[model samples]
Structure formats: structure tokens, C-alpha cells
Target: MDANGGIEIERKFDVDELAVLPPLIDLPGVQAIAEPVVHDLEAVYFDTNDLVLSAARITLRRRTGGDDAGWHLKLPQNAGRRREIHAPLGRDRQGEADAVPESLAQLVRVYVRAAPLVPVARLTTIRVVHALIGAGGETLAVLCDDRVQAERLVHEPASAAWREWEFELVDAPEDLLDAGQAVLAVAGILVSGHASKLARALGDRLTAESPRNRQRPTPTGPAGNVLLASLGEQIGVIRAQDPRIRQHTLGSVHAMRVALRRLRSVLATYRSLVDPTVVQHLRTELGWLAAVLGGSRDEEVLQRRLAGLLDREDPAVLLGSIRDRLTTRSAADAATARHTLVVALDSHRYFRLLDALDALAASPPFTATAGQDARVVVPALVTKEWKKLRRAVRRATGTVPGPERDLALHEVRKRAKRLRYAAETAHPLNPKRAARVSGFAQKLQTILGDQHDSVIARERLLRRGGVDAYLRGENTFSYGRLHALEQQKAADAEALFWKAWSHRP
Candidate 1:
């Protein structure tokens, strides 16, 4: 969900042609009903050739003839919730056609990659609305009795008509939905089987719209199925976080990067299950994407870290304008980094990479070993990853407190993350053991991750304290103090990591 997105909480019911509108004043907490208002609404739904968006339970439409008329992108959330994003139906370059807004289109690029969007369904809704006013005169909800005429534009055109009621909350208590449903049930109006009017219009055709067009992963089946499942979940996170990154949502960049890294780790850890050639390509491209998201996130983290350090320092030790300088530099770097990330996301390379991922999800390139039993295959893979982390830890423990130790700890952190993901993928086979292993692996990753962050922080502090401060003619003393503080932080993380490792099973 982005800036234009909001949660849509509504309950819809199917009714007879002559279903009478129930008495509203008698419903719980209702004080009055505003006079009915009528509006004729039209919505044109769009999707790819195979109805990819439909398969994903997403709907994108260019709608007209309502108080709110534009483009609507509806994405499924929780069982009773849908996240709806609105974008103005902007004009074509020559005003010849109504083009989908870029803001909305970009959000769905992961699902719609390399496929053209065409009209799939058209719906005409004649809606009569009655506002359900609360005792305080607040419009808690609105009830719309709709007479819908739907026409399927794709694959053997068809039409259908129906009457339905939409009970949507405005500012009402969400439990009001249960009450409204009970009322509609009493009126002998059952909940609509259709998820949306478009689904109803498409009717029989929707049952035919199955994700079976893509392969389903099963734990008892191909070993590659497990890898694909893991890969698919991470891919979804990467896609879901795209718009959040655009909105500059807190921690979004880190989330996207972590997903990208997880995908790479899965490919690397399960190298025997997938084609080496395809795995290399995906791992390389995923690394590229992660790098693109990393710049801004690093600056954001450093800014916070430095700010926290400064806050804890004695007021008298604070140098002249040091805080302002840090703020200005960080802000400028973040802007540049954010712009670069946006451009990269919108680039043809990124889109092509997404297309490749979609293709991979639909039909992963599996190797001969992929057909083995997961119970045997998964444990071996998990053990292999654990050994890698163990080796890295041994090396880090052997090193003294120097640059070599810092580098070794960073390597250990990366391996720990790999082991954690591998253990997670192995969970279906042995939940108890997988959980225990994953727990220890994550503890290692977290503390070592902090150590890695401190390592980078020290390098950054050196540059800022030496070159930047020298050039700006600011006090260098505070920078040295902060550098020393970061070093201590790194030592603390190392100690914690060792303590956790000593107790590992």
C-alpha cells in the first residue's frame, strides 16, 4: 500500500430482484437514515492475457460515473480487508485513450511484467445509497443497493444482471459488519459468493482462471519445489515492498534488500537442486538489485546511529555545529541515494529481471537431484549451510581484535543468515529441530549483523572525522570520540555473539 492506498472494509450480500431495503433505524446504534442518493457507475477492468492479476486476486480498473471516478487498484489483504489504491485516470499523450496512471501501473509491474494490459470486463452499476447516521450525527456507514449489469469483454463475450447490497463502514466500529451481516441474513440475503462484481460478470470463466497455469510446490514432491516455495515467498516480499520504497516508508529499503539477499541465499544453498546457469544469473541480478537498495538504507542507519551516540554524550563535549553538519550531510546523501534507487526501479533492466523471476516462479529450472525426497535432501542442505557458518565462526574466534577479525565476523554474519534461511526451508521436514537451529542461527546473524554495521560505521566515521571535518574546519575531537564509541559497540556485539555460540546446540 502506498500514499493513495486505503483499507476498504465492506460486506456485500446477494439479494432477490425485489429485495426490499430493511429498516435501518432499528439496526444497532443507528439514529437516522439520510435521504437516498442514486448514481450510475461504470468500471472497466483490465488484466493480462491469461488474467494474471485475476489469478493473484488483484483488480485494476479505469472506472467512471461515480462520486469517485478514476482508476482503482484493489489488492487483497486479510480475510475481510482489501487495500484499495486510487489514481486519477490521466489522459493519453494525445488524449486519444485513457491510460492507466504510472503510479498504479508501477505497483503491479511484478505481476504484469512483459504482458500488455487489455480490457477484460466492463460493469455498469446503478447504485442507490443511504447514509447510516450514528447517534452523534456521524455517518458511521453507507448502504448501497446496487442493480448491476456486467459484460465480459474477454473470451466469448457474455452479460449478466443482479441485485446486491454493499454495507461499507465509513468511521463505524468494525464489529458493525457482523451486525450488518446478521441483518442481511435475516432479510434472506446471503453473502455473495463472488469476490467482486467483475468476478460475478466473469462468472463461469473465473473458475477457469486458475494459477495452475503456474506450478504448485509440494514438500513431498520435487526437492526443487521446496526451493521454489522459498524463492516465491521472498519474491512476493520484494514486490510488495516496491511501492513502500517509493513512499519512503520506514525500513522498506532494508526489507526489500533482505528479501533480495534471501533469494540469493536460497539459490546458493540449494545449488544442487536448480540449474547452475539459471541460478548464477538470478543470483547476480538479485545482488544488483540489493546493491541498488543498499545505498539509501546505509545512510539512514548511519544517521540514526550517529544521532543516538551524540544524544548520549555530555552536552559540553558537543562540538560547534557538529550536529548540524551531520544532519545536512546525511540528508543530502539520502536524497541522492533515494533518487538513484527510484531510477533503478523504473529501469528496463529491473523490469526484465522481474520478468525472469515470474518465469522462474512459473517454471523453475530444476536439476536431476531435484526429484529426491525432501526429508533426506533438506537435512543435507541445511547441514551443509550450518557447516559453512561453523567454519566462519571458528575463523572469527581465532582472530585478534583487528581489521582481519572485523572482516571475519562480517563473513560469519553472512553465513549465519544463509544457515537461518536454510533451516527455515527445512522446517516442514522436522519442525522442532529446524526451529531450534533457526533460532541459534538468527541469534548469530543479529549480533554479528550489528558488528558488521559497526565495522562500516567506523570507516564512515574516519572519513567524516578526518577529511570532511578537516576541510570544513570543524572540531575533530567529537569525531574521534564517536569513532571510539562505535569500536566499543562492535566489541559488545562480538562478545554477545560468542556467548550465544558457546550455548548453541
Candidate 2:
């Protein structure tokens, strides 16, 4: 059973007393599904250039004798969160590590650094599973019982060993979780307190005990280092989002692009804080990743909007093959962009760039401009962003309130969003002021974003009629109506932006 496009919701609990229900597999009202038992399974995880990925807070593993056995790459999509990808095991557990296959390796290029893939650890789990189902016979959740053990570097002497229970939920409701927990509470069976057992087990590699988690890097002189560190973290975020975007995860592409823009925005806003050469190089790479992924993301956004429009359109008004032509063209363009993204991720240059980024992050090249504290540092950043916004607004202001104005305003809106985020981060000094700025920036951005989306949709509609026959099907009316509505929507938003920005912050 391959699962895709399904939402995975997981919640963890703390377990205390285990002396509860005599290892029973059946509930009081339910039949005994299977006798309570535990089975041992061994797995060896692999990674490139060494165990560096583990440092990035991710794990790639190949396991045997497990209920689900395969090559698993548990990528860290966010803090305390992961997206697991499982591939079937090879014919034999041999010859599996073949240069970290480009498709997969590209997903983790930011962390692996071109390192040759190798086995780093062996984990053995003694476990039991209970499957819960709903009234309609749909599987809900799988409760796992486990005793875990680990040996570092399967071939070498053991370096790490630990034990813990792991609970992974399936298609269960939130309320049922509360009910189950209450049952466990009454039985004196509690949940595990650890956020993740892997973190506890690989403490040495992860610096799990380090104070660095909460401690912001000690600010040197003017806070230049702080800016660089922020930029680096954003870069990491963009790279981490790559795999999710490829999988067409909702909002993933937009998020990654935002990170890129933020990084670029930082450079533009704080030009005096760092060397221009460094900023230029990073910007180049950022542009490259963005351009590569742009097609897929843009198509996705347009397609989603077009579909909605098609749903509402009067069937008769739709023109010749409009929707079909656009759909085909978009799919082809999206595929090409995806390929380029994957290839770029696998390139040696990309790896080299990541390594350089790591080094820069660990120790940024700070100039004298960094000595200022938040009050001084922030105003400069915000001012720079404001100037960029101002220029874009000015460019957009004189244009006829049409597509060109809409597009230019959209760019300005983006600048406003970044500036707003930067301002929000600086709220500690003045909460009310930050709150006001964020609110204003948001309204402008929303209007601009909607307008830009409309423009794109209209262009797509025009192309659809000009091209493919597939789009000429029963849904053509939707495109024309949508295009007209979007045009009106953009005009309305522009009016809103002017009304709001008129009162300066």
C-alpha cells in the first residue's frame, strides 16, 4: 500500500508505569486480534560521506526482518518533525549502496556533502503492534510496543546503546487519542517522555546535551554575525524544503521560495553589513535554485486556481481548447523544471556550495558594522527593505492600473512581506509598533499576491486556447470567467493598498 497525498498527524505521550494490562492484545469489548508478543528486528542505516546527515537532524536507514523493511530516509522537514520515505529492500541486503542514487541523494544534498554512502549504525527493535479501526472499517492508528538497542557502525565496535518505546499514529481522530491516553492512564501505562529516542541514542553525534540549542550565538561587536547566521539558517530551510516541493506537498514550494527571498532580502537590506562579493555569490546560487523550481510551483498555483475557476464558469462561454492547451503545456513545463531541480541538487557545485555555507554559518565573516544591538541593527534592515518597497511602488504607481501595475505591485508586496517579517522578529523592543507594521505590510502583500495570481491565470487561459486540444474539452468556459474575475480582483486590491499605505507608519 503506497500512501501519497494524505495528511499524517502524530502526537506523542509520556509513559511511566508499564505494569498495566498483562500485555493483552485485545480490548474488553473487542475480539483478540493477536496474542500479545514482541519480535526483534534489525536495521542498518546508510548515509553519504559519513554520518553527517545525522548532524542535520535526519536519518536514512535500510533495515531487515522488520514489518516494514526497506530503505528509509527520515528527513527533518521542521523542528521535531520528519517526513519518512520508504523504498523496498533490494533482492538481497547486498550491493545496495550505489552512489546514493541521484533521485534520493539529491533530496539530502544540503546535509550529505557528497559523502560516499555508508552504514553508520545498527538498531534492533523488539516490538508489538495494535491496529485500530473505525466503524467503516478504516484503519486508524498503530500502537507500537518496543524495546530498542543500538550498535554504532555495525562492522566496528559498539559506541552507542539505548532503549525506548516508539508510538506512531495512523488515520486516527484527535478525540480517540485522548480516550486511549485516558485508558492508559487508568491502567498505569504512560507514554515516553523523550521527544525522539534517536536523539537520546545518538547524543554524542547530535551534541544532544549541548546548551547551543537555546543559546543564540554570542553577539560580537555590531551584530553582523547575527545577520549572517540568520541568512545561513534560512538557506538551510530552503534546501530542506526541496524534497517536499518535488513531492508536490501543499505550500512547500512557496515556503522554500520565501526562504530564498528572505535570504536575498537580507543581503539587499543590509548591504553595508557584509561584503558585496559574498552576497553576490550566494544570490547567484539562490537564483539558480529558484529558477529551477519556479516552473513546477508556478504551474501548481495556476492549475489550482484554474481548476477552481472551471468549477464556477458558465459552460457556454468557455473558448476553443483553452483549458486543455494550458494544462498540457503546464505539465510539460513542470516536469522539465523538476528535472532541472533534481540535477542541480546532484551537481558537485551544489555540494561545494553547501560546504561553504556550513563553514560560513559556523563562523561568519563579520565586518565592523555588526557591533550595533537590535535597536540600531533592525532599523537599518527595515529601512533598506522599505526603500526597496518604495522604489517598486513608485515604478508601479505611474503604470496604468493593468497587468503591468499588478505585477510590479506584486513584487513590491513581496518586499513588504519580508520587511514585515524582519520587523516582527524585532518586536521585543516595541511590540505595538511592530504589530502595526506587520498588519499594514500584510494587507498590501495579500492584495498584490491576489492580483499577480490573477494576471498569471489570465495568461495561462490565453495560452490554453492557443495550444492543446485536451483543454478544449467541456471545461473551457471556466478559464475566461476566471481571467475576467481575477482582473477585477487585482484592481480592487490595488485600491486597497493605496488606501492603507496612505497613512504612513
Model 2 CA deviation exceeding 4 Å by range: 1-38, 76-84, 92-107, 123-150, 154-156, 159-233, 306-311, 398-411, 457-490
The candidate maximizing TM-score is 1
Ten contiguous residues minimizing lDDT sum, candidate 2? 208-217
Candidate 1 lDDT tens digits, 236-310 = 888788877876788889999999989999889999988799889989999998898888888888888888888
Models 1 onward score TM values of: 0.91, 0.73
lDDT of model 1 at residue 290?
89
Please give me the total number of clashing residue pairs in predicted model 1.
0
lDDT of 1: 0.84
lDDT score at residue 241, model 1, on the 0-100 scale: 89
Q: Candidate 2 lDDT, tens digit per residue, 1-505?
A: 2422123344444443344333323333222333445667877766543456665656676666756666667765543446777666554356644334444555676666566677666778776766565555655555666566776663343554444334344655555555666666676655655445454455455443111113242322245644655665676676667677656677887788778767766666666666678778877876776666676678778777776776677767666665565567767877787677667767887777666555556555656675667567766677777787788888877888666676678788778887777665545556787788777787787867777787777776656543433343445455556667877776786777788778858
Each candidate: RMSD to true structure?
2.8, 6.0
lDDT of 2 at 20: 34
